[model samples]
Target: MPGTALIVIDMLNTYDHKDAEALVTSVRKALPGIRTLIGRARASDSPVIYVNDNFGQWRSHHGELLQAALAGHHRDLVEPIVPDEDSLFIVKARHSIFFETPLAYLLGQLGIERLVLCGQVTEQCVLYSALDAHIRHFEVIVPPDGLAHIDPALADAALQMMQRNMAATVCATDDITLDATPPVAEPDAAAG
Candidate 1:
């Protein structure tokens, strides 16, 4: 069976943006859930992949980006979920993790057919990534508590959309099962 991967999205933020105030509040609430999911993934030996926004540093690598965030004022947020040696990092400049990135190819290489996504910006990155994953025929799981958002209402709407339109599983962190066999991807009729 193809493996399941736990994707951590845009969690290494510096919190300097204009929308940081509301986002930080949501992120703080999401931290424990995201952290718990990460620990669970590690314990199960599932791949833990972190996909972060580029923050407009086109040349920056993962380590450099991580250090920059760690040096920023909001180190407390970035410190707890720091990627471990076993974790893989992917850099994304856009809202969708698959947009102009190697993530799709990486997942193919890893034989990752099911993705459990956790992290920030529910109304934006997380939402877009779920659509992209769905279209690519991967089973997508989004744990609401593991997500942060700039606007709670929009985030809730986004989650609903993802659940209904994209057929993503909306569940809690404790309910995730990384080792269970993923359902085979159904052929997309619209693609024909």
Candidate 2:
């Protein structure tokens, strides 16, 4: 059983969005780190879970998402981090990966207590999902270099908030270690 799972959020993109160009540049910069982390997670025998946006493809599954991304103009950005045969995938429709998704239940089912989150739009989906994971009592780790963002400033602020407010470890990909025992939550200062 894997104690920690690497959650790659919203990376199987078509590169056809309103802010695609800026995002593409960041994705290119972040690609190597993402690849390295994915490879490390696989080598550790931990679960590599790709939780992606459905892209309004209401009838499509993970296979369709992977195919569409591979066929897109930015195949360079999508190919390296594509899910493998042992990878688990879940398609989400909202900003948070847990929104209307079976991810929470799945995490419980898999006995995943800690999550290492990476991928695109650090200010949006990653931030929201970090909050959700925090509230659900799952330890969250964010590797800044492994993430892509449209705005670097917002991304930095989001990382800060995740660390300060959510108790997430805003770390580098090289610093990430999937340990079995998640850090115990601090007692509420106001309660005592």
Candidate 3:
């Protein structure tokens, strides 16, 4: 049975960009849902993977990244949801978590065939990552309530594309079942 993983993307952000205020506001609103989902995933033993952008700091480590983000404007959004001791952290140089990162190998090693994606910039990183995951044949699930975006309209469009083009399951955090029960193998279906 393949396992399911909760992929939290680019949440360890230092809100210093031009649109930081708007993004931070959105993230603040989504924090509760993200926290709830993380708790459920932890309770169910489903892997919680934090896929964060390296922010062009090639020499920076996860610890440094965490510290930098926590010291930023929206520490509230990054602190409470910081990776737990058992959680896995992967640093990515690009929007897609699978791009030039060890995410795919790690997921493969853990036998993760399904992914629950959540976090910042719904129209960018989350969108690209979902597309990458789809092409790689992984089942993708994105909880709208668990995501935040710089632009609402673009985020909505991105969600629609993910749903229509990649067959991603766009749902609310409360509606998702985070049980760690092994996934029963099934036959291949059309690419999402």
lDDT of 3 by residue, 1-192 (tens): 458899998999999989998898899888998999899999999999999987789999999999999998878878889999989999998889999998898887777899999998899999999999999999999999999999999999999999999999999998888758465456468653
Candidate 3 overall lDDT versus native: 0.91
User: Where is model 3 more than 4 Å wrong at Cα?
Assistant: 181-192
**TM-score between model 3 and native:** 0.92
For candidate 3, the per-residue lDDT at 145 reads 93
| Model 1 CA deviation exceeding 4 Å by range | 180-192
Judge candidate 1 at residue 29 and give its lDDT. Answer: 96
Q: Which stretches of candidate 2 lie over 4 Å from their true place?
A: 179-192
Per-candidate TM equals 0.91, 0.91, 0.92
Residue 76 in candidate 2, Cα distance off native in Å? 0.5
For residues 1-192, what per-residue lDDT tens digits would candidate 2 score against the true structure?
A: 238989999899999989999999999988998999899888877788999998898999999999999998799999899999999999998999899999998777767888999998999999999999999998899999999999999999999999999999888999988544333357699999
Q: Which 10 consecutive residues of model 2 have the lowest summed lDDT?
A: 178-187
For model 2 the local lDDT of residue 97 reads: 87
Give the better candidate number (2 or 3) by TM-score. Answer: 3
Candidate 1: tens digits of C-alpha lDDT, residues 49-155: 99998779989999989998898768989999999998999999889989999999988777789999999899999999999999999999999999999999999
In terms of TM-score, the best-performing candidate is: 3
